[model samples]
Target: MTSDPTSDPTPGSTPDPTPDAVPPTETVRPDWAGIDRLPTLDLLRLMNAEDRTVPAAVAGELPRIAAVVDAVAARMARGGRLVYAGAGTAGRLGVLDAAECPPTFGTDPALVVGLIAGGRTAVTAAVEGAEDRTDLAEADVAALALTPADTLVGVSASGRTPYPLAAIHAARTAGALTVGLACNRGSALVAAAELGIEVEVGPEVLAGSTRLKAGTAQKLVLNLLSTAVMVHLGRTYGNLMVDLRATNTKLRERARRIVAEATGADRDAVGRALGATDGRTKDAILVLLADVDAPTAAQLLKASDGRLRDALERARHQGPPPA
Candidate 1:
């Protein structure tokens, strides 16, 4: 980060946001001259070694990452959604993370969303310089009917991308919680977000090609952000993913193991309980613990606001007050 938080080393948010600020060359390399003669395997080895350093860059942002998790968790508890907005590779990564939330945490599809400039088609194909437009970012969020309770995360490696920064500013205007993630220090993208996480991984091995170390760093940070938020939302019981949606055969087996592990029950017993309760592990646990039927256990979960421990504690302390 720059010693002066107000100064943006990136473009768009700064008055002197010239092309020099976060120059494209910082992330890209001229591969045509040297790559024509080198062995493909040698080039692959160099890329792999560069990719290995991304985790350490992410590790440096743990404190900022925790702040994002806490804020996102609070917003979610209030019925606010988490929205990831970006352009280019950063935008696609946002989409990827949001797409995974449903099966991993049993969250409603709308609860976590992603918006990229140029829309869904842009995810797989370049949309002819879409990231340069600032207005598109604002328009996408407006279409979502954004609320103050929502949290918007903007991703950009250069920290100067017009689309992501514009969306962050717009999200803030709606009183939503905002987070900006970039790979450059004192980025305009960071300045726009209420909480900025800049993981400076330095220049890429391939000259200015950001898809190298910088892209890896952003992916790791995003993984931490979403995973931590899920943990805070009670999606897990101890180390077990009690709320995972078992869609495929492998996942069903994983779910059975989770229930058995949590309850100290055999696979047959676990399967029966889970089947009876519509494959809900938490509900099955409540039924097993309270010695009650499915509906009764479900009502307890509802009354306790879906907090498993609280529901079970209330069940245990019933029939009180002998005067």
Candidate 2:
């Protein structure tokens, strides 16, 4: 809980604990806290119930999440990047969200970057002296020459991680839009950003180990942030990933299926269209519907700036090509 600067910690009369970095130890415990004594089935049920709370907690923050997404989409539409910064579980979540964007929405990797305090090594294994150093976060953001147009999101379960907050502060200083995602209400991290998203998931199941509910909330929030941002950027067409890059056998097959699904065409027809456009779904769709080859389709896509609907319409209805 937060308090006024002049407020006392005691109910009636002491110093408030608002400045604390770690969550305080609680007096009350869950009835099933003593796990060693519980039956296996009972323990599993308790865990599942706790897991179910995560989604609800995330749902409560949708309004704030939507605001952040609109700001991010506006910046990206102007040609700026989106960057994620965090530590530990939050850091890994940031990295995972950024990594998945390339394959899922077909964005360039450079468009969305994730920076963890301990670098790539901290992703799998723990690294000491990482999150404590805000300077490192500051330096990383500084080196990127992050401009006023970019969007920087900092994730921290505790709401007090120095590294993440420092990144947020640096991004704001550089004139970029900043967002802070934390699991505590009225967190300092939240206060640091122009926009704050706090998902109150309560304390962790494991005492002092925030990797439980806090991590779950962070994961869910990150998923929403990235997915919503992608949708706003026009990466999806009619609920389908029409711009996906067919880089491998699996993705190639998935791309074909997506084309067939989105175009209401047969698998054979989809394959022929895909072949004509060299495996580009949007291009192939235009080629089939407009009876054009890859170059003409690509030119049409350029004319429409990657919005498949506009490209297809122009390809079918536009005046003769310019001399």
Q: Which window of 10 residues has the lowest lDDT sum in candidate 1?
A: 1-10
The C-alpha lDDT values of all candidates are 0.81, 0.81
- For all predicted structures, in order, the TM-scores are 0.88, 0.89
TM-score of 2: 0.89
- Tell me each candidate's RMSD, in Å, in order: 5.5, 5.9
Candidate 1 colliding pairs, count:
6
What lDDT does candidate 1 reach at residue 114?
91
Model 2, range 1-323, lDDT digits (tens) per residue?
Answer: 22354644333112233543445321125664797777989878876888898899899999999999899999998989999999888888898888989988889999999999888999999877677667778888998899989999999887777778889989999999999998888787899999999988775556656677788888888888888888777788888888788899998998988887877788898999899888888888777667777788888887777777887778668831442
Question: At residue 118, what lDDT does model 2 achieve?
Answer: 83
Estimate, for each residue in 1-323, the C-alpha lDDT of model 1 and write its tens digit.
11144554333233335544554327445553475467999877777876787788788889999999999999898889999998878899999999999888888999999999789999999885578667778889898888988999999888887788889988998989999999988888888789989897876776767777877887888888998898887776776787789898998888888888878888788888898889988888877877777787788877776667777887788621122
